[model samples]
Target: MTTIKLHNTRTRRKEVFEPIEADNVRMYVCGPTVYDRAHIGNARPVVVFDVLNRLLRHVYGEDHVTYVRNFTDVDDKINARAAESGRPISDITAETTQWFLDDMAALGARDPDQMPRATQYIPQMVTMIEKLIADGFAYARDGHVLFRVRAYKDYGKLSGRSVDDMIAGARVEVAPYKEDPMDFVLWKPSGEDQPGWESPWSWGRPGWHIECSAMAYELLGASFDIHGGGNDLMFPHHENEVAQSCCAHPEGDFARYWMHNEMLQVEGKKMSKSLGNFFTVRDLLDQGVPGEVVRFVFLSTHYGKPMDWTAKKASEAETTLRKWRTLSEGIEPAPSVPAQVVACLADDLNTAGAITELHRLASAGDGAGVLAGAQMMGLLTDALGEWARGVDLSVYEALLADTRDKAMETKDFSDVDRIKSALIEAGVEVRMSKAGVELLPAAGFDAGKLEGLL
Candidate 1:
């Protein structure tokens, strides 16, 4: 049995992972607010946790692990996007949610066991809020329900910030109706146009933080094995969830281990739309960058480190994947993944290390081993093999060979050079030797451009 170790953000240590029940390993990750397309930054956690989920299913029985990632369909951002687009909120959320699922599926991410939409869990949320108020951890005021942050002694334990420090450094919402400045909203009143539900306080919607807490509780229970998200959510979002959940249920430990992947960057700078570098997963996919290539570039860097998305990396990833695909063509995976690759994944998900091991396997010319290893890391699978399907170069090869023969006899290399240049421009890697001409597709290869180029 391989022992997995993960960096627990709550305790600030890398600890050995142990499920509350060996039969049922559970995890919850904060998912997207389905308002628009998912950016590259948003896709990081999906891939990172997908790998973790795969590893868990591999270790525990496939049916033993329960992974839950929520869809926050009832957010203010969704409301805003609906207002801007003049579309109904339900229509916008449904379209964007399917788009998200399609984009992630293209990236080789397996859907979680349970994807609970916030709207589906609203009754459960209302029930939890009622319990919090009864337990004196929350109160209703001015048609709004706010959590009493001070009620939980260890309010800032997860983030390691005192309430006073948070109030000083953070933007504490200064509402005249609130009792304490640091008090956060559990539920807020919604207008007629906005999405809302009937509650004891008012017709309103759940807050951003409470959505996760409530969904996690209903699906995963009061305590689960792991909770994960981007480090950006560490401060107020996760901190407030801890306060509300702990105060609501004191007996159960909320999440045994916490994991947070670092933020992503583009070419060493922050990715922003105004900077002309921000793009979604669908944008890259539509531009002919294979989804496997995107996944490779993402796994090259450790999840805990800041992953930089660069064109050079993408090109290199495409080339390497093409080579591996050719070598492992028609080869089936081994009975089990290699021990070295499994160990690398177990050691805090050292994916970069696992990739290094894969390079060694490729160098050793062990095609089956390499195929199995890559599949274990969710790469080079048959599902993502469409990008590697070779374009027919036989006709072009014969034409180039025939042209070279004529050039040798007539000393007229003009035609040969013209064809060679055209192939290069079309992203075909041309290899001309005494034997014949061999053409391979390189990165940025556009087979459509070779329509008229005999």
Candidate 2:
């Protein structure tokens, strides 16, 4: 059992985790703002975090981990889209949420243990907003509500920006209702046609930051073991979330460990749909990249490093990854996953390091060991995202062809079972990968046909 140390964005240090409640990991990931189909930028966090989730399950018992990722179904974008499309807000949210799910599924992201919707938690948001106002952390004006930035002493700690610097650096809308330019919206009034909810602060919907704060509280509780998202959210979004949650419950720690993955750039620039450089998860899926390939590309780099997407680059990576599966031809049970691979994953999820180690293991002529090492990382699954794409299955397919004939023509009942047993001993999955007694010696297997008594 390897001890893991994760960089906690809150305290600015990598701390060895001691689960507050012991064995149970209360982890929360900032989920998608469901106003449209999620693009590649969105999928990076999904796969990266899913890897984190996977590593944790492999580290701690899966049943002991409580992973909660929320759906921001109610948002300004959802409202704006509804107005322009003449669709009901609920319809827009539902449609966009489904698109998000479909896109994430395509990228091979596992569904979180809990997916709390903002629309469904309006009451929770209201309760948090009301408490903030009562506690002098938030105020109301002109059918709107604004969170008082001055009230939270350490508001900009997460992003390393001082309060004054943050106000200057941020590109937030300068709404007239705000008491100060730095004061972010807690709730804003909506028109009759727009999405609205009856709240203490006029008839309006919850603001962006408050919704997450409320959702995390409702699902994971006041403080949890870890909270994660993309680096782009460090400021106002996560910064404000820290403010609201801490101010609401002054004595409690909102989230102990904060892990944020870096952004995915496209062609050396930030992935922006407006710039036409953004590709949706579906777009890449259609390009013959397996979901695992996408996950592999993401994990191949340190989660904190900027990853740029290019068709040529993705293709090259697909080839590089496929070379790892070189010798399942003679295998038995799924290769016993290597300990070093598991250790790399446990260490703040240094996926790139783990992959390097995987390649090292593969370059070893020990085919059995290589199979075991790769299988442990869960890279073999097609559900692993686009990483599985463009894999050259030629060699493996040849092995499969040989196995089929072997499983077919055996007239001796005793011989049939014994041959299948040998295939399993070779780490060749009989039903899944290569089945039957069909023997095509790998590039160099003793292809001699042996006549033996069954």
Candidate 3:
């Protein structure tokens, strides 16, 4: 029973969140275009929204939240990559999408309720494009379907940007067929080798922005609870979504709240491949940074604030998480869950505020009380998939037994002492494990450096 407020990008106001249905909350996030690996700069929104997803489920029942993130598999960028690498589009897309999943999983992001792909939903895109054309919101010219920007009166509402301003900063080429310089594509004709579907205008693929609008409408309906992405996507990307969805539906308003997290920078500069700062999530993971550490580093700052991806920050985040994890280990599961975190997360996903409240709980509360506080704060046990208590209890139980067995089986007091010392050094305190010996990842110790001690 806590109140949550989120900043709505469309309204330019922070509004209290009320689910469309009592407990069922639908959230749609724009996902990756699978041309290559998901870079470290690309992970801020992934972690930020994941925290929101965790808080929402804790607030409502876990089953009540339906999260949908889409995959842009048929994009021109992916096609171009395929041609350059001499790989098929499917191969490139599949490889990149799997890499995205693997790296994100390492960051402890919960798998979305549904991860829809554009290619799989081609019929939905085609049907939507046809409706736009029929409804006078879209037109086909030279085997391509384009959205008429001027037709939508409130086109600039989301970004708070005027069409004239967009024209001034326009880096995109104005094609001859476009009705206006600001006009964008709904569908474009495909070449012989690229992926294409049969459509009324031509054999082609859906455009970038249209895929989300189409997929969101098809899966989550016209109005969803929250729509989210990186701030870089605000302008032409999300603005077009608002126009497309509103023009297509014209009945219910699209997502009730629009949440955009700021961009990621490397050492205070924009992260780009040409600048040589471009780094994938795997790039960090391979360097021995814990995914939990990565998640903490992302949540440590305000979502609206641009964060720097640095090794030092990641280490600092790990130390921060270690303290919380140590506090969590002191207490047992409680019958009653804590309520403070719900309100903190509800307030525009203020995870930093939630962490402060957790500090209050750990510093002053008793065992049961501290555990209750941790529950409300939503720290995954063993950093398991966002908010869920990680690792089955049987694992804990078995480890306990193992610790005891180790004590009995080995009469080498020196070895027992060595194991204990090593465990403590690695961050865990060794007692009689459930299976005879139990080993917990030392929350405070240099678990990574423990290998040398052992």
- Writing each residue's lDDT as its tens digit, candidate 3 over 279-374 gives 888987786567777777777677977888776776566655555555566457566654565566778887777667766766774445545644
**Clashes (N, CA, C under 3 Å) per candidate:** 0, 32, 25
Candidate 2 residues 1-454, lDDT tens each?
Answer: 5677788888778778778876888899999888787888888888888877877777777898898999988777887888898888788788888888877776567789999998889998899989999999999999888899988998888888898777677676687788888998889898877788898768888889998899888888888888899998988799899999999988779988888988888888877768889788877777656665676677778887898877666655565555554344345524456778777877787888888887786677555655665555556543552332343334544554554556567644554456555544432333434342222222111112222311
Question: Candidate 2: where is the Cα deviation over 4 Å?
Answer: 273-276, 329-336, 365-376, 382-454
Computed on alpha carbons, the lDDT of every model, listed in order, comes to 0.91, 0.75, 0.77
Q: lDDT (0-100) at residue 258 of candidate 3?
A: 93
In model 1, which residue pairs have backbone atoms overlapping below 3 Å? none
Which candidate leads in TM-score?
1
Better of 1 and 2 by TM-score: 1
**Best candidate, lDDT-wise?**
1
- What is model 2's C-alpha RMSD? 9.4
Better of 1 and 3 by lDDT: 1
Question: Per-residue lDDT for 351 in model 1?
Answer: 91
Worst 10 residues of 1 by lDDT: 319-328
For candidate 1, what is the TM-score?
0.94
